[model samples]
Target: MRYLLPLLFLVALFAMLMLRGYVHNEILADHRIRPDASTDTVPERILDGGPVIDARGTGKPTSLDIPKHKLVLTFDDGPDPTWTPKVLDQLKKYHAHGVFFVTGANAARYPDLIKRMVDEGHEVGLHTFNHPDLSYQSHARIDWELAQNQLALEGAAGIRTSLFRPPYSSFADAIDDKNWPVIKYVGSRGYITALDSTDSEDWQRPGIKTIVKNATPKHGKGAIVLMHDSGGDRSQTVAALDTFLPELQGKGYTFVNLTEALNAPSAHTPVTGMDLWKGKAFVFAVQVSEHTTDVLVGGLAVIGVLVFARFGLMLILSFLHARKVRARGFRWGPEVIEPVSVIVPAYNERECIANTVRSLMASDHPIEVLVVDDGSTDGTADIVEAMWLPNVRVIRQPNGGKPSALNNGIRHARYDIVVMMDGDTVFEPSTVRELVQPFGDPKVGAVAGNAKVGNRDSLIGAWQHIEYVMGFNLDRRMYDVLGCMPTIPGAVGAFRRTALERVGGISEDTLAEDTDVTMAMHRDGWRVVYAENARAWTEAPESVQQLWSQRYRWSYGTMQAIWKHRRAVFERGPSGRFGRVGLPLVSLFMVLAPLLAPLIDVFLLYGLVFGPTQKTVVAWLGVLVIQLVCAAYAFRLDRERLTHLVSLPLQQVLYRQLMYVVLLQSWITALTGGRLRWQKLRRTGAVEAPGGIPTQRGSKENIDRRPVA
Candidate 1:
């Protein structure tokens, strides 16, 4: 009897769904009026949300009637690459743009074409991540659906979206409680503008002319026209826009973005006279707090290792890494045509500045070394001046910071090819030549040199040793494989002066000026290169205090750079095509990779902290295997010593905590609107050790030549 009841319910539900679908599809769609209409039809459809179609001073009256000659020709559920292009061609024929409510997944597939619509001055608005009934979705899914679409589509269309029309307009509106939460959520995410005008039930199978004829009522004002460009073959819809847009233009009407038409009233206008679209901002929180205990225990293990025996291990690893570089036997290939101008920015480093200058002086590549003293009070300028080598020049300036120093150097450098390096870093003899040689291609805007720790005598050094060998080098390689070299490591990166000038020089708006500059180069349509063969040695933070200070700036600075140039990521200009499409995506990664990445930490912590149990013990064993593979991979990438393997667990624990701590601090600082300070850390504070070039690979093999990029 119970089974029979359930079966009856299922059958009835299916029958009702079929009945509803048939009737819903059969209903006649309401007609909408466009702005570029003849003054003839004016008695209906001026609808809610202010002067329809921004008719201000066009002498068009509000709350007026619909126009008979007015036509809203629309395409919906598009854009297919093949057919969308055809449709765009047809629209271009008539100089018209339509409101496209696209599905999110398809939007990602044809990014360039979508960008084309925006570039041609058309409107591209959101239609959600996929075609889903909002009422049936959970609160989280609703927000994700909208956010993913905004991130992917807004850049393509070049317009910030405000018009949000439901798939069936009334599907969620009718479902009361089940759907309103989602609508409310979308509003919260800054999608408050609703479409009052609906046109074209083109999701239906209809003749091309019929789709156009049905929407072209005699006349109405401020009507939002809806169309699909991608549901099925939309050749007909494309053809209709071809015919109708010009006809409307001929009739003295103009097309505009739906949101612009509705919400963009003058500030002086009264609330009743103006329609202001209101929506909430979207927030996504990937939850992983269920494994808190494990994180604490793993963190303790990391601290324990930091307190002892870490330096001896760092020395061993650094030695091994240098040996690997030497084993490559000095990749002696061709000569670099360009003699490079290497700019070293020194803030207050008195200890390492002298050695860095000496290392570069030994380089055989025809080079000019400019030490930019950013108001160094620590005698860094004195040390450089004391060297007094003819090629070594010190430019003392107010402590405006790295970007300002680089900008200043850019004006003074006579050479077209410029290499920028940190004052704390020491380059190998041929490193400058290796880093510079890749600019044979005119498009190559910048190049990155591999950075290894010069002071590997502590846990900090060991951590950096592992980082250089594995994370830094490997991640960069992976990025290259993915077709982008993310940030050129700030220690030693080179750029062409031409590209720098094109992007308005480096901005002081960011803390990590290197990342900001690199991204700007891409935006200017230039290429960034990574040269694994070119290596520089930089001292790591030797203590907790030092580590925190450097990292705080790094983290906060990254956030600033991402924020400052975020607009360039997707909007196109001479230099912004790459930046426009790339910056937002990279920012997304910088934001998400941390919060969602902790699941792996959860798994590791489960094993490390609670591993007395059999399951927990098994997980720890798995961590051991993963760590070993990571160690070897890290070594291969950067050529580090074998000693980093034993210190892997402690390093991982500390690394995770550092990431979390920095992330939190960045958020707090951003919220408080605090300026990022340059708090100097102890540089020469490494526990004493005998240091030299990683092998006898320190030969001063110079190739004297003139600079050419």
Candidate 2:
């Protein structure tokens, strides 16, 4: 069910996107009208035939000329909202009937006009959807055009049209090798090709008098006069029609529909049953897609604004934060010289426990190391115990979760200031000193340290390394300036024992214990800040599966913590301040932003495949450039090498999608009231404490150093 829901949502989203592309004339748009070139395949009879040609007959194609003094007036490229109504009004004023050839795109958009034509005793015909030149189209394309046109007519007026006119068509004598085959194929599909006998050239917007003169038949002969009610300013056509209808009538000429002039039955057949319903369904889907696209576009605009606003805020405030921290006189009170107790929570972490413990013993600050073994089956506790190092204690417990183990460690600790880190993490020699320095301020409750990916040489690790530097650490700096730092890294962080007791230790209600406790400290009116110099290197997941599991838990847990503290928004004092500022920031940047971020890529694909490729590429690259600028600044602030950033673009393409899917699944699980358990990742112990202990994997000397209990 988890997998199926996201798949269904994506499929529906894609379907709506395609429908919007089609309706907006982006997909399969007609760009150029082919010019007359060859006539090698044309028969002389068709070239000299009358306006109404019936090539459906088995023998030579037959043509019918209108009887004397009878005129067939036809309009093309219509059902236009502006000009179509005026044409229909003029037709009604004269009590004249004409054939309106409507394109499927316009007809589907303005069905009322098509219905009005049918109700006013006028004829409707197909002019091909999108007004594409059929001479250059394939047979399948020709059939699709006819079928889609018929579908629109059926949906609009419950009738099917057999009268067809190819776009850019002219008098029958102009038929050439290129278009003759198209006319025949259309004929084979049961349509009567209605060519123009006299061209009014109204689309060119000639003078009304010229249009009227051009439309009049020579020598009192019957003819199919072609004009337009759409495709341009048609006031001349309307004015010409007004003058020509009565002027021709004064000359004893009658303006009749195409079928009447041809002496044939009505070309429109009433549709019923499933066909009618299907046509209505298609129209409904298009309407819904258009409206949905409108809403999505508006949302895209809003997200675009929010994204830029966030970047602007980060860039400005990060600069301020750097200046504030780097100032010559800046200090977090006097240097914190008190001894500290560091807690290491281990659960099946046999690969990295030795490095983790030795890193703490190597810290510049005076400290005691407590390795809380949470029921590891891989002899994780035995390895630590076998080391028999002084000032390091190995505590055994049942297989409780991380929060439970941390709470146990806190209860057993003897120092007022306590530091916590993951068993797979290795801290620098000065990390503990730097992390605890913030506690010199009496109000400081917790300090968040910078977490670096130690296994960053792998592709997945490189992507995560970029995210930690660009996304996570950069956000921490901005949040620090705002006084709403949300999450402290579980890999390395420091807290006051009094503050921990006041906030009831770590709560087991959320998977993100670090974030939950951090928020708790804020609500308790204690300050939580970021320490950029307190860096801890942890092994990042190397494979996609492990990354997915880790991020899924983190995403879901962050949401849980946010929801759990939602009431703080309405509370008074520090709680209210943090809630109003912290929660909204977290929700916007962490939750809503990532959820809607995919829209940029989605539209990029849409534009690349459908149209406007250059603009699309420029827009997408512009956004990428913005991200690159931000990332480069972040890397410079962290003082890290920038070569790993070469994978940043591919990370946006592939890695971000995996993160989006994981976050989406987390949302689904959260909303559905489904619970998730902690997922332990396999560690390779890639990180090591400098100049302390050689914890390399399968080192014979290190193994031999382990004394028997």
Candidate 3:
């Protein structure tokens, strides 16, 4: 059920985006009209017909003309908010009515205009939704356009219009072979095709005098005139109407709508019941989708800024960190060469415990390894006891959680400087030595070590390797510089025993004890720094399910840790610095960023399917390039091979989504007050030891191997 929530949310988001595209005329739109189309199939009678054409009967088609001294005024492409009301006002001033041919797209957006047209005694007609040229549309498309237009009309004004006008239509005499069939089909759909006898050409923004001249009939003849109330810059059309109405009225001509001019029945019929409700539902959906899309676009902009800001900060601060560490004679203060106590918390880690113990036993620094076996039913303690290596001891206890086991080991330790590691991790010989060097600075409390993915032979492992390098390690460097280092990895980290005592031992309040303790140390006025030279190789989860579980706990636990220490934000001195700086960075980069990162992919899909594909692809690839550059820089800093980057793009396509969903599930669990226990991943013991040497099962040959450097 938890997993299904994210999927359902995505489905709903996709649906809203699709609806937004449809209502905005961004999908399946074709607006071109062929001006030089063939006219061989057009009948001679239609070429000489009147403006009102009727082909609904089985016999010959008939056309009707307005009575002498009577003019029918028709406006196309409207119900526009800007100009349609102005045109209607002019008609009302003259106590006249005009027909408004509205496109469904515009009508749905500005339904009040349609209602205003009805309430003010104006006629509304169908101009085909989206304003597509009917001559180029299929029969099904024509039917859909007409039906959708009627639906919009029904929703807006509770009436269906029978008056029809194809987009780009002009004079009745201009009907060609390409358009004759479309006109007949429309007529068969029970609509009277309203073609123009005189065109004002106001759509071209011609001067008012030219428009009035073009729309005037010769010798007091009756005619149907075409002008526009929408489709841009209709000021000339509205001005022409003001003058044309009064001037023509003075010339003994009366203006009326199509029905009045033709002396025929009303072209609009009132609708109600299910049809009315369905229309309303459609309009409602479009409105909601439009508003939702607006909000998503705003979020996308914010995410974009956050992404760029994070990348900029990482690059700048990481360079500063590298320069500071690599500077000659730079050290974390004088090294004291103190012997450290190492703790390995084990629970059903029989497969990797021996290698973990062997690697620690070979550390270049003087160290005593204590394996705290927390009631491992798989005899994880037996594996370490069988090793019988010098300076390594296995302690057995009941199945307390990892925090309890670590606290037990801390109590039994004999060294002031302590190193903590996971049972499945193998550290380099110099890792402990390098990790403990940070403690030479009296103010330093805990040092976070560099953790690497050792099982990188598989695709999933390679992806994790990239993340560890690019996302985790690089972030640690930046955070270290900012004095707000959040987490000391459980795989490899060092702590001052005094600092540990000051913050009380590890708390079981959060699943991420590492992060929880690090924050506590910060609030207790201790410095947490990163040890880049301290590297540990650990097996990364090789399957999607395992990765999801591991990350789910990590993400949720981080949230819990953040919440647990939220009060630090209001504290004074060092605690305040970490709370204000560290907490916001963690919350942005770790939680909120991952949650909103999927918007990039969402818009990419939307653009490809709807339109503007070239721009969309370019934008997406641009983001990918930025990521690639950052990854390359991180790999260089870590001195890792760049070959693993071949899977980076694929990771963005597939693996990023998994991480996003995992983060989302964690958010859901946190918001709902759910509890999560320790989820142990099945380990294969495939991790390589320090110096890239593979660990062998039950092989004592390398137990006494000399420490490297």
* TM-score of candidate 3 relative to the true fold: 0.90
Error of 2 at 333 (Å): 1.3
Best by TM-score: 3
Per-model TM-score versus the true fold: 0.50, 0.87, 0.90
Clashing pairs in 3: none
Off by over 4 Å in 1: 1-335, 572-585, 588-591, 595-612, 620-624, 685-709
Q: Kindly list the per-residue Cα lDDT of model 2 for residues 382-447, writing each as its tens digit.
A: 988777665677778899999988999898888999999999999999999999988878989999
lDDT to native, each model: 0.60, 0.88, 0.88
Q: Tens digit of lDDT per residue, candidate 1, span 150-180?
A: 6546434433555455554521113233333
Q: Evaluate model 3: give its lDDT.
A: 0.88
Q: Which 10-residue span in candidate 2 carries the lowest summed lDDT?
A: 700-709
What are the root-mean-square deviations of the candidates from the true structure over C-alphas?
A: 21.9, 4.7, 4.3
- Expressed as tens digits, the lDDT of each residue in 408-490 for candidate 3 is 88988889988999999999888899899988899999999999998999999999999999999999999999999999999
Residue 48 C-alpha lDDT in model 2 = 77
